[model samples]
Target chain A: MRLVRQLFTVTGLILLSAGYAHADDIKLVNQAFKEVAVVNAKGEKEFKLVEPGTVVPKDEILYITTFANTGDQPATDIVITNPLPNNSRYKAGSAFGAGTEISYSVDGGKSYGTPETLKVSGSAGQTRAAGPDDYTHIRWVYTGELAPGAESTVTFRTIIK
Target chain B: MAGRGYKQILSRLAAVLLLGYMDSSFALGTAANTVINNTAVVDYQVAGVPNAVNASVAFTIEELLDVNVVSLDAANVSVVSPSSGRQLTFLLTNTGNGSEQFLLSVDTALAGDNFDPVPASARIWIDANGDNTLDTLNDILYNGTNGPVLDGSTPGNDAVAVFVLADIPAGRTAGELANVSLIATSVIADAAGEVNNVGAEITAGGDGGVDANIGVSGAQSSAIGTFEVVNSGVSIAKSVLVFDTQGGQDPHPGAVLRYTLQVTVSGASSIDNLVITDSVPANTTYVANSIVLDGVSQTDAGDAPGVDFSDFNISNANTVTVDLSQGGNITVVPPASFTIGFEVTID
Candidate 1:
């Protein structure tokens, strides 16, 4: 009776794989922010790390999100989405995530497209190519499987208003 | 012989008194509207019965009216057109003998001045507290319904503050002089009415009374205080501050930038109807909801009632329009300035 139960379970797994395969476990994500500061060290302007919550006018902040696969099984085709913080503008070409395909949203994440295809309304009421500041959301699509106990981080920079 | 002796003694005593009185009379003649008097009595001891006689002398001082006025511009008030808060200050002194009051008036519609249309509804103010400072909180507003009183107890010791309040007409250029005449008429006793003394000069009366008529009856003094509408207009300056991985303020692709606009009102005046507008530059995107005014974060879409995001607009052009003169708030008074900032990224 136990052997028969084992066979039935194996058959169920095969059937599920033939149809729509789902990830065995969901990935856990952590988010935080940091400001970018330019410090004058010995008369040279150098980039410095500034803790979050101390941003000033004309300062830049970096939004970082870390994802970890804590489940016993691998996670596949993982995707992450983050909204642009208020009172800030996304830095052009600042999004970075290794081994991930990137896309942006300007319509409150309802739709997304590449930078070349995205467009926003200009002051003249004419639709023009969207700039970095128009981006409302950013998404990263992981092409490779996230092995168990694996971790990855995605980051983007924004300027404080 | 007794009659002769009495006559001699009386004559000698009278001569000594007369000489002393003459010296003092000449010396005390300096002041006007003054009175000096002397009395003398003679008695002879030979009659032991004490027969006595008395004499008196009196002098009435003449009256002199001199009105002197000096501009007290110590506050460094800035005169902006179409504004009523501009203060033109002056000091009025009695300079004459006896306590008296003066009627105050302003003439904005004077010739040889730069104002196209003279200031309107001119009013007067007084330093009632005697702090020697012109502050609305502490000073008194004198509308000239009653003239100002200068105390004569201490001649030249009492100086009355005269502040002229008027509305500068709009479109007056900078450096244009608004010549205003401050007519101060002495309040004379038994004057025909509250004397404005406009058509004629007042004279101090041989007698005394308190009416706005200066001259012989009292003595009216006229002084001219000018209100020059300073042209220090509002100025708007714009600059871009940027941050990129490559460094420097020069914006790069994917670099964020802060656009700053500084508005300043220089000179000695205040201005109104201050409106500022700016459209996001090309090749850049405005960060959504990124508008800051005077160090406070503001909303991008909201209604106006207080310090909300409604003070600005992100309409066509991703533009920003700020009205400093919001229903008379934020009037650009001279020596005042404000700053506004927004964010964008280079495409």
Candidate 2:
């Protein structure tokens, strides 16, 4: 009876710690897609996003990141950061997220600012306003709190170099 | 683990192929089979506690198939009637992003030409020595089976020298033209129809089992080389310089007329016993000791062993003869020129 009591106590302690670790429960999923031109049922030509099977130079790719608050409490101060992949250049004005402030980083994610405020040093050591090609990372700050079990998505595009 | 090993082998193959050429700056973009990995992270606060989560995705670049062909010959190759072994040079390049083999062919019956090269005598060869000249002994002939293998993974190693040779028909005349085309087709299966179909994938069809896609060149290219028949002979341009008694440019009596003969040999063959003879003008007197061959004065005496090969009034009276071949002891090759000058007095 003494051994059984000791086992029950250990199991209860493990459950308590598992619950404590679940407090910060946010899940993230990232995906990539390529656009293809196809004719719909009405015979109108339109572009549709699909899985990229064969990519070549200059092909555009769309990246989407979805985050969900799986905890019981609302998640606040939500921030998402993404570093652009190699052999690719960011497309201008492609980042999209509702109710969020989007910014960019040109100094290898050390600092972030809006497109007009961001600066990058040219090869000649002259500082200038950063362009889409100079972007090395992208960040999004959600303005509002995320309710429990609420999911939202942010997207951007890049072209293979 | 197997995939990583395969990728390593593919990279080694690419390096080996890169050694074929010395300089390469023409590659388009990211190399084939390069992996592009992306990851995104989310940081948020749950009940005032900071936490983070991340996700990742990755894919590999595909190979692109393309090729380019150009005529290396600046102009039409000069040939002679009933000639054999005339060559026209060309350059074949693989512009795609993979190592590829090509099937070569020649078409001698092109339209808009003066004549056609003998179809049976037409042949193709690879410039094995890279000298741009067709060396039959060192170059490999295209027997409709073997073709050039070019490496497109790098820039400098992608091009190869090609040559097309043909025989001139016996009845062809001078100034006639014959056009020949060299065609190079990629040996990859179904490559012809899939050309320019961007994003179309061929599974395990590229170098080292990588997938390949069609590029802009459509995987096939051809260029034309022409053969022009030219007469193999000699031509002369004669200009006269007159020294009148008053040093004026008039052919008057007692005035000396110095005639300059610019002789040029054309075509490919050499001539033996190249003897040049000229008669004195009707009313001009022969100027003794005035015969000159190529800026050197010649003795006005019969041909001797060491004296000279020029003499006046030897073959006929009032005639000057200059034996350029030195009594058949030398051969005068074409595309060669000589200047012979002599002065005569007006009667």
Candidate 3:
């Protein structure tokens, strides 16, 4: 009886693998950059994002994560989560993601909510509304399905502590 | 389907019940050579199948070479001419993100001063005893080669007490001022001439194998302390001998009060225009012909032409004046003193 049950389990795993062989459909890339001011031919100063070579405290960094559907099938219920880097604080109102609902987690990545709904425990043991500095992780849930070969990007900013 | 759904709910509830501890903030920002790693995870369903992928990026924090030098003295330090071992206190802090060694220097030939400190007399010392005082016996003298190494990781170990000692030059008059500066520079290799280079980087020059970058302080700082010359060596001792009727020392009517002003001068240089003036006490009458200089009688009139320099009621009413300089013709040298005595009767 045990040999028959193991044989059936092996068959079920093979069938599951064959049915969803293209499970590696999504490709993600993350990069960090900093802004620098440059003067144009018109003598006007403009800010531009450049590779960060030497970042120091109080320097703002832009983090961009790009995702693409590499398979033939559409990807549904796409979610991306990122924890704030160490020695950094999230820049308020800097998260941007089109066609997706953005939420934050003050309790690591366990649960998420809007900034107004999220709460954190203060050093004095009191509960208070979570601010951008209190956010530990950020989550974005794509409402629309991502078609095959479709690509999108999410970006946020943080300041080095 | 119901059993799977129940398991998913239970896992979600367990996750919600979990607590996460927050990291404490770093006062000096991130430490040097710290690698900050960030990763993002993507989860999606393709054809009812679950998949997950993550991407990561990391960078190392460079060292910030910043230093602060401030004079801890509240005001100008008072010193007598020809004095040695006078010290000025200062605080040297490594306001950076990495441990740093500083090379200390002192400059005494500053502008806008009446005199410069004695050449080669300026020295630096570390307050090894933490007493905030310059103890020649306990404090470690800072030789040109041995600089202080301060740890910038914590506030308690980031600052050090410094003392600058110099000798006051002779012949500096009272109210004369001199300025000295204590300079501290980062001892990182090739850190010279990089002051105010806020973003300049030195590869692999910091502690813990980190790159060193010049901060807003330019890796160097200096603070100036002033030394004001004061005539503290000149002193005066006053005494009074009261003689009442029947030679009794009592304060009664018709009693004679003899006041003596003993003037002494000591230092490297003589003082000119040494004048002594005293007013008659209240409810008393000045005794005529009672003025004496160095135990010699002086007339009530202001004598001249090689005569005495003591007189009664000359400058002000009931006031006795004695010109120790003999009308600016002499300089009262050091190790010398003179006595002026005058009498007043009780009214």
Candidate 4:
């Protein structure tokens, strides 16, 4: 019985050799990098509050925007536009770029109105009253796109009624 | 014996070797074996290295294009003086990996050849035209004489740079190294359209070696020193030394002309305690007195002076002056100034 089993095993070896007859000499390897850890820097101008002399009330505030793209791709045509809210006065030349529209509000941020310099088409009537205690968030709209690895920003001042 | 995949792999290897031999396409990069266990061999001979430090220029194109630069700039050059007053010299050379043009100058402030600060000039001439090799112009007359004060254009040539020292005032340090300048400006034509005027600083060194800036085949140079003494006693400081009394002057009663001689090394090397012997002529007489050095007086010969260096000095019978001198640090030097005096009464 043992001789028969050995004979069958030898036959099986022969069959296996006849079946699949190839293999690859495997090898492990290491790779290297060309460059890494890039860094950069930038400069900004000091933000000047329009009312330099007088003491501003608790409701009034002023600050500027500093934006960073941190992403691999850059954003263009970034825009930030803000209108003077109630009780707030828009400082001249405070905007970074030339905006197509310029208007003002005496009542809080609700009603649409033009500056006193622009004439009211009809008689002034029941429009919401704008005052210094109103919230003033400015809007900045842009038309161009920021490129990869680039950044930009905008800013303005406001006083809450 | 070949393994299981031996035939297939052998066929592939044959194809690779054949492809490598017949094709430039398989010459570089991972194109042939892109997937070799994630590793691809990157090998190339190191170029741009021939002109680096410690490299020499040869007669071949490779060596010429890779000529190295050796700067003997005064930055590391210095002159050492034996004593504060001993004369000293600094040597700076370009001993050349190729034709070198340069300047060797000094600001003799303290411890230069002279105790004074002397920086005369940096005017040197080179073979501007590479004429023959040395940039020697026929017009260059060294020291107002013929030839260059220090001129060598041949790759391994050398030149001795001489700087005159100034008078060391009392209580002052050795003047610095300056007023001496050795500059070699090469008029080379670069890749640009015009000729570029470039130069190198050459320093002074005492010996011959690489740092000496002399060259591969090094040669040494030397500086000479001298000093003197004068007795306000006469037109020419009396040679109080009495070798003869014929022309000697008589001071008062039966007195003979006497003098003093001081020898010091103001520059370069120093002399050993040298005994200068002079025979008292038949007409000369000797006076007993002591010689002073470093403010201390010692008898040249005591009637019964115990220890004998008696050979060092002999008086009366035959006058001998042993100027036993030593330099500061190295040997015979200066600044540790030395003066020897003697008194003689004649018959």
Among the numbered candidates, top lDDT falls to: 3
Off by over 4 Å in 2: A1-24, A40-43, A72-77, A91-135, A141-152, B1-26, B128-139, B171-175, B190-201, B230-233, B239-253, B258-342
lDDT of 3 by residue, B1-347 (tens): 12443244334323322332133354666677777789998988877666677899887777888889999999888888879978889999987888888999998888988888875988899987778888889988998767888877676788899999899978988888989999999988335556667678887877677778898788989999998887765688999999998799998999999998888886545688888889889999989988888889988788475788877788556788888888888888775888888899999
DockQ, per-model, please? 0.00, 0.28, 0.28, 0.01
True contacts kept of 2: 0.64
TM-score against native, each model:
0.38, 0.69, 0.69, 0.26
Worst 10 residues of 3 chain B by lDDT: B13-22
Which lDDT tens digits does candidate 4 get at residues B227-298?
222111101122554444455543544565455655544433333454434444345454554444445554
Model 3: per-residue Cα lDDT over A1-161, one tens digit each: 35643554455456567765254578998988776667989998655667767776656777878888988778999999999999889977777776889999998888999999998887789998899989999999999999988888777778787
Lowest lDDT 10-residue stretch of candidate 4 chain B? B57-66
lDDT of 1 by residue, B18-63 (tens): 3432111111112343333322222211111112222333333333
Q: Global lDDT of each model? A: 0.58, 0.80, 0.81, 0.30
Worst 10 residues of 1 chain A by lDDT: A20-29
- Residues B112-175 of candidate 2 have per-residue lDDT tens digits of 9999888898889998777887888999999876888877766666788998888888888888
List, residue by residue over A40-149, the lDDT tens digit for candidate 2.
99998655667777776666787878888877778889999999999888877778776789999999999999999998787788988889989999999999998888
Candidate 3 clashing pairs, residues 3+ apart or interchain: B196-B218
Global local distance difference test of model 4: 0.30
Higher-ranked by DockQ: 1 or 2 = 2
At residue A23, candidate 2 shows an lDDT of 29
